[model samples]
Structures are given as C-alpha cells and as structure tokens.
Target: MTYKPATQDQLLAIRANAGIAELAQSERYAAAEPDLVEAIVEGVGQFAAGEWAPLNRIGDLEGAKLENGVVRLPDGFEAAYQAYVEQGWNAIAGSAEHGGQGLPFTLACNVLENLGTANMALNLLPMLSVGAIEALEAHGTDAQKETYLPDLVSGAWSGTMNLTEPQAGSDVGALRTTAHLIEEGEHAGKYRIKGQKIYITWGEHDLAANIIHLVLARLPDAPEGSRGISLFLVPKYHLKDDGTPGARNDVRCVSLEHKLGINASPTCVMSYGDNDECIGELVGAENRGLAAMFTMMNNARINVGSQGVQIAERATQAAVAYALDRVQSARAGAEDRSPVAISEHPDVRRMLLRMRSLTEAMRGLLYYTAGQVDRGDIGEPQAKARAEVLVPMLKAWATDTGIEVASLGIQVHGGMGFVEETGAAQHWRDSRIAPIYEGTNGIQAADLVTRKLGLEDGEALQNLFADIARAAADEPQLMALAGECAAIAKWMREEASLDDRLAGSVPYTAMCAVAVSAWCLMQQYDALDDSNDADRKHAKRVTMRYFLDHIVPEAIGLKASATAGAALLYELDSSVLAA
Candidate 1:
C-alpha cells in the first residue's frame, strides 16, 4: 500500500482551526501564502512516498551494524540522507540568518509528518539535528553559531544530545561525566570532557561529515545534582583554528544496542575523552547545562509527539488498505452472499474507524500544539505559556495513542500482523519507543500535574479550559464533554491532593487531550462554509460526528480514573503481586 499525505481539505481544515494562516500572515512568515504552503507540502509528500517509504522495510531487515567502533547504516540509508540534505528539507523552519529558509514551524510539521510516516528511523536524524540547531541558536556563543549552525542547518553535519549514562537514565544528576578546563594547549579555555554516554542516537554515523554532540558533564567545583550540571559542545572531530574539521576527537562508539524497532537508527554507547583529549566548549553558564539541554529536549519532545502522529497515520493507512483488499467472511445478513472484502465486516470497519479517528485526533492535537509553539517563537507570552502547558499532554497522549492505534492496525491484519512480513508490526514496534523518548510518558504526566499546572498561578491551565469551553459553546454535542473536562481541570487544581493528582496524572492528561481534540474538530466542523466543496465538508462533518459518538466517551472513564486518588495504588503489599 502506498503512503498518503493528508488531503488538501484536511490540511486546510487543520490550518484554519489552528490559526496557522494567521501565523503565516504575521510579519515573521510574510511569504508563506496558502498556495506556496500547499505546494511545499505536496512536494514533500511525493518525495517521501517515492523515496523514503521503499527503504523502510530494507532498513528494518538489515538494521545498523557496529564495525570496528564505527556505526554503519543499512543499504541506501546514506543516499536517502544525502538527498534529504540536498533538497533543503532540514532548513525549512530553521533561522534564515543561519542559511535556513526561515519558514514557519507549522509548515515543517507538515513535511515531517509525511517523512516520518514514510520512514521513521531515517527521519530521526534530522529531527535530532533540528533540536540541536534550536539549542545552539538559543544559547551558543556567537562564534559557536558562526562555526556550527550553518552545517547543522544545511544537514552537512548531524547532532546528538548526550545526557544518559549507565546509572543515570532520568536522574540526570547522578551522571558521573566530568569536564576539566584545559590549562595549557591550543584548545585552552575549553574543557576536556570525560565520560561514557549511553542511548546516543546517531552518535556515530557516516551520513554526515561531523557529529556535533551537546553533552552534559560536571565542571570542577560544580555543585551536585541537576543545578550543578553544565552543557558542552563536543564535536566528533576536533575543529581547527580556521573552524573546519581537524583531528579526530577522543570519542568512539563503544557498542550499539540491538533494539526491537528503529533498528536502522544507531543507539550507541559513546565513550568521550577516552584519551583525555576530547575538548568541549561551555554552552551556557557553569552548572546550568540541564537548563540549556532543556531547550533541545523540549523541541525534541514535540517532534516525538509528531512522531506519534506520523506512525499512527502510517499504520492506519496500511490497515485501511489491507481491509479493503483482503477477502474473508460474507456479509452477515445477506442470503447466498459471496465472500467479500474484510472491510465489509462490521468489526473490521470498527477497527478501521478507530485507527482513522484516533489518527486524526492525534494529528489535530499535534499541529495545534505546534501552532502554539510557532506563536511562542514570535514572542506571544500567553501563547508561550499555553504551549508549555500543553507540551506534556501533547507528548504523552499522542504517543500513547500511537501505540494503541498501531496495535489496532496489527489487529486489523489478524495473523499477518503478528508476522514481520506484514509491516504492521514494525509500526507498533517503532511507536513503543515514543512513549519512552525524550522523557518517559510517566515523567510527562508528572510534569503536567506538577510544574505546568502551577504556571502563572494556574492561569495557563484555566485559559486552556476556557478555550475549550468557548469552542464548545456553539455546538451542543460538545458541551457536556467540555464541561466534564472543565470539572476535571477544577478538581485537579482545587480538590485533588498533590499525591492524588500525580496518581491520576496519566488519565488526567488523556482527558485533557480528548477535550482539546474535540474542540479542534468542532472548530473545523463549524468552519465548513457553503463555499467549500460539499463532499469535503461532508467528510469533515462525518468524522466530527464519529469522534463525538464513539471516541469522546472515553473522556468520562478517564475523568473517573483521574479522580480515584492514590490510596488503592499503594494499598496492596508488593509481595502479593510477586506471588
């Protein structure tokens, strides 16, 4: 089955509902007219479906290999990456000052959706690089930007965030990586970093000339825990005084982890300063590396959420195609009927709709959150806060939905889905990591109920509820669900204890996502004017109804689970479960 990009009607509907057009009209993106945006999206879709999708199976089958401390990608992987760079896709939303196109992030989101659906593992390279470019643009010294940003934006160089270690996974403070200032050498004033970092994606690859690593290590006299941690810009190869690639840095890919999915993406264990000669420059202030790294992590989180949307879209497309082509049982009520496509079966149709509706909802939430990010980039304070508040929900909910939808896609394929040949299993395997990527879903939910809820004395959250309420006001069907969400928000803020809130944070996040997605769909439904094509409008209307009737009810169960408190969670003894 061929991969399909979102329809013109769907894209237009998303843009209209999410205020992407208004963002385009802003002075920052003045050149992003509707036609140009549509054309760029279509071009990317064509490229992704034609070029990247074909290599997905091959990449999965062959995966990446560790040969003599160098990570070698699967066949055709390097060529695809070169074509990606040559096409200038990496710079679509990058800053123009650094050789980027300076387009809006919303446009980038569209391109990435297609690319990721076509090939997820390959898409991760640019995704991580974009996050690195963002961090450098935000905190890198002027010289650093001048030396690194151009190559990163041009895709000639790739980037990696190195924070995890053998013992420090989420507890970044427990990391043992150390950096000492170089006293006397050509690289004096820089720090010589030493440590082992694990789970480093694309840490070593032949796709790029250089790999710019944003590493977190402790400086001498640095305090303990997260506050004492600092960020460093460490390159795979040392840079010459002329700002070109120089001697090989004391960094090596010690090994690669055999993974269940995204095998094409090299997950490496990197040893820095193996010879005590790896030089790294400080990024922000001393003992503030975590803060600087957050810039990259936050950007990566959104892209991870977008990954969820992408994989779900891909799975749904495959499932629907399979359902329409595979013949099985006859129609239930028809006498003397011949066997028909499984899509004619009620259960299969139900599964297809589940995949379709959830994918659409996840996309709406992802793009809407991205629009908030774009507005925030343009210095809208409220928009910034809103984007911050929604980031956790966006990451957790969308990824969870991705896993569920991918599993459903496999279910739609019956026995074939269980086998590696069907390709349905790959999506499920690939999506599994998204919940754990950037930060685990558990961490995201905890952040939602704790830090994000406390922002602006809860004004950010209140504003979200108000927006949903206002959007639901015009449509009576959405009112009850909107009210339920409002009640949950209030309970979360005023009634639930902190521990209780944490207990239900996952479900609470889901409830919020459902409400937000419902609002997005309602906006699209209401925006369908008579001038629009009838069939397109009708399809939107039907999807909106299907979501309301079948999917929105999940919010109620989520709300109940969210308010259930932590008592039952810890009541049982640990030994009972073991027995």
Candidate 2:
C-alpha cells in the first residue's frame, strides 16, 4: 500500500487551530511563515514516504546488530540517516543561535508524525536527539553547548538519554551510577562516571560520527534518592585539543535487547567507565539531575505522544488499504451477490471508522499540545502552565489510544493481521512500548493528578476547564461533554485524600484527554471553509459528530472510575493477586 501524508486541508486546519499565524507575530517565531510551514510539512511527508517507508520492513527483519562490542543499524538505515542529515532536517526546529532553522515545534511534530509513520524505529534516533538538544540548550554550561550543540543540531552527532538502570528503572533515585571528581588528569575538574544504564534507545549506533549521552548519576557527597542525582554530558569519544573527535571514551554498549518491536532501533545496556576513564561534565548543578533530566523527559513525553499519533495513522491507512483490496463475504443486504471487498461489510467499516476517528482525535490533541509548547516559548506564562498540565494527559491517553487503535487495525485484518507478512502485527508490537516509555502511563496519570493539579494552586486546571467550556458554549454538541469533564475536575479537586485521587488518576487523565480532543476537533470544525472544499468541510463535521457520539461518552465511564476511590483497589491483597 502506498503511504499517504496528511492532506493539505488537514495541515492547514491544524495550523489555523494551533494559531501558527498569530505565533509568527511573536518575537520567538518571527521567521515563521504559513507558506514555508506548509512547504516544510509537505516536503517532510514526501521525504519520509520515499526514503524511510520502503525500509520499514527491511529494518524490522534485519534489526540492529551488536557484533563484538559495536552496534550496527539495520540495512539502509545508515544511508537514510545520512540523507536526512544532508537535507538539514535535524536543524528545522532547533534554535537559530545554534545553527538551527528556528521553526516552531508544531512543524517538528508534523515532521515527526510523518517520519514515525514511515518508519518508527529509524525515527527514534532523531527523536532522542531532539530531547537531548532541549536538555542541553536549557541546562548545559556554555562550554558544553558550544562543544556539542552544532554537531548535534547538524545531525553529525546523535544523542541519548541514560536514566534507566537495571535497579533503578523509573525510580531514578535508586540509580547506582556514580560520578567522582577527577583532580589529577587531563580531564581534571570533570567527573569520572562509572556504572551502567539500560534501555537506552539508539544508545550505541554507527549512524553518526559521535553519540552524546545525557547521563543521570550521583555525586559522592550528594544526598540519597532523587534529590541527590545529577546530570552529566558524557560523549562517546573524548574531544581532542582542537575540538575534533579523538580517543574513545570508556562507554560501550555491553549488549542489545531483543525486543518485541522497534527492532531497527538499538536498545542497549550501556556500561560506563569499565576502564575507569569515562569523563563527564556536570549539567545544571549538583544533586539536581532529576530537575535537569525533566527538561528532556518532558520534551520526550510530548514527542512520544506524537509517536502514538504516528503509528495510529500508519495502521489506519494500512487497514483501510487492505480492506479495499482484500475480497471477502458479500454484503448483508445482498442475497445472491458475489463476495465483495470486506470494506463493503458493516463491521469492517465500523472498525475502520473507529481507527480513523481516534487517529484524527489524537492528531488534534497532539498538535494542540505542541502549539501550547510553542506559545510558551514566546513568553506566555499561562500557555506554559497549561502545557505542563496537559503533557501528562497527552502522553498517557494518546499512547493508550494508539495501542487501542493499532489493535483495532489488527482485528480489521482478521487472520492476516496476526501473521508477520501482512505488517499489521508489527504496528501493534511497535505501539506496545509507547505507554511504557518516557514514564509509564500509570506514572503519567499519577503526575497529572498529584503534581499537575497543584499548578497555580489548581488555577491551571481551572483555566483549562474554563477554556473547554468557552469553546463548547457556542456549539451545542460539545456542551454536555464539557460539563461532564468540568464536574469530574471539580470532584477531583475536592477529593482530599492523596490515595483517593491517585486511584482515580488514570481515568481522570483520560477524561481530560477526551474533553481536550473534542475541543480541538470543534476548532477544526469551526475553521473549516465550506466554499473552498465543501466536501472536505462536510467530512470534518461528520467526523467530529461521530467522535462526539461514539467516543465522547467514554468520559462518563471514565468519570465513574475516577470517583470510585481507593477502597476496592486495596481490597485485594498481594497474596490474593498472586493466587
């Protein structure tokens, strides 16, 4: 099946909904123009379909290989990556001060969506690099940024985040990795990092000239737990006197994980300072690694949400294509009719509609969230706060929905989806990890309920509800959904017990996602032009109505779950669970 990029109408609607034109007037995005943004997204879509889509199956089959301590990417990955770099795609959304094209993050999200749909595993390399760029740009010292930013932004060097250890996982405070000050060597004043990091995506690969690792470790006198952790910039190869790549660093990929999906992306168990020579420079301050890491983590969480949208788009497209091509049973109304395309079957149509609607909803939610980030960059304090509150929901719900949509795509294919040759199964496998990465969905829910709700003493969430209410006030179709969400938010706010709030967090988060998605879809509906493309505008309205009718009601059950309290949850003991 031929991969299709987001249509011009969809991109324009997203831009209008995201207020890209208004943002362009701001000092931060003065260089941004509507035409240029459209061109960029279109070019990205074309490039991805042409360069990366063809390699998706090959990447899955060949995977990443670890031979004698070196990591080699699947066939075509290296060449494709080089072409990507040469095209200056990596610099599109980077800061102009650091050799970037200075585009808004919304455009970046669009690019990522296209790339991820084309080839998720290959897309991960740049995804991690963007996170690292954000981290270093925010927290790295002047020297560190000068040394790394240009190459990283230029895609000559790639980056990775090293936070997970076998013993630590999400409990970053439990990390055993330690960094001690080096007082007597050429790298004096820097720290010598020693220990291991696991689940490092694109951790060790030959795709770039260098790999910069943003590592979280503990200092000697640092306090125990998360409060004591510190961030470090550890390069794969130490820099020479002239700032060129020199001798190898002490970091190495011990082994690669055999995973259920994303086989082309190397997930490595990285060993640092095995030879006692891994030198790392501190980023931000000592005992503040978690804070610095959040800079990257938050960025990654947003991108990860986009990944969900990406896979859903791909699966939906593939499923629709298969349904149109594969002949099956006759329509229910036709008695003596020959077997028609399964798309002619009502159940298959339902599945395809479910997949398409959810994917559209997710895209709306993600693009809106990305717009918030862009707004925040332009000195909007309220926008920044709203973004912080929405990030967790975006990450958790979008990913969960991605998995659900992919599963539906598989079901639409019936027996064919279960087999590897059809490729539907791969989308399911690839999507399975999104909920677990960048912090598990459970953690995201917990963060949304506990931490995000506390923003501005709860004013942030209140503003969010108010905006949804305002958006729905003129549209009768959305008012009920908006009211339900507001009521849930009110109940959550009044719930005093931490455990009670935590128990209901996941559902509450999901409810918020549905509400926001509905609001975004309405925005698209309002912005649609009947004169230019009447059919497309009508289709948008129909999709919005379908989403509200079929999917928005999910908020009701989710609300019930949110207010269900912690009693029933704890009623089952560990022994009972084990049994």
The 10-residue segment of model 2 with minimum total lDDT is 7-16
TM-score of each: 0.97, 0.98
- Model 1 earns a TM-score of 0.97
Task: Please give the RMSD of candidate 2 to the true structure.
Answer: 1.4
Q: List the residue pairs that clash in candidate 2.
A: none
CA lDDT, every model vs. true structure: 0.86, 0.88
81 Cα displacement, candidate 1 (Å): 0.8
Backbone clash tally (model 1): 2
Judged by TM-score, which candidate is best?
Answer: 2
- Model 1 residue 527 CA deviation (Å) reads 3.4
Top candidate on lDDT is 2
lDDT of 2: 0.88
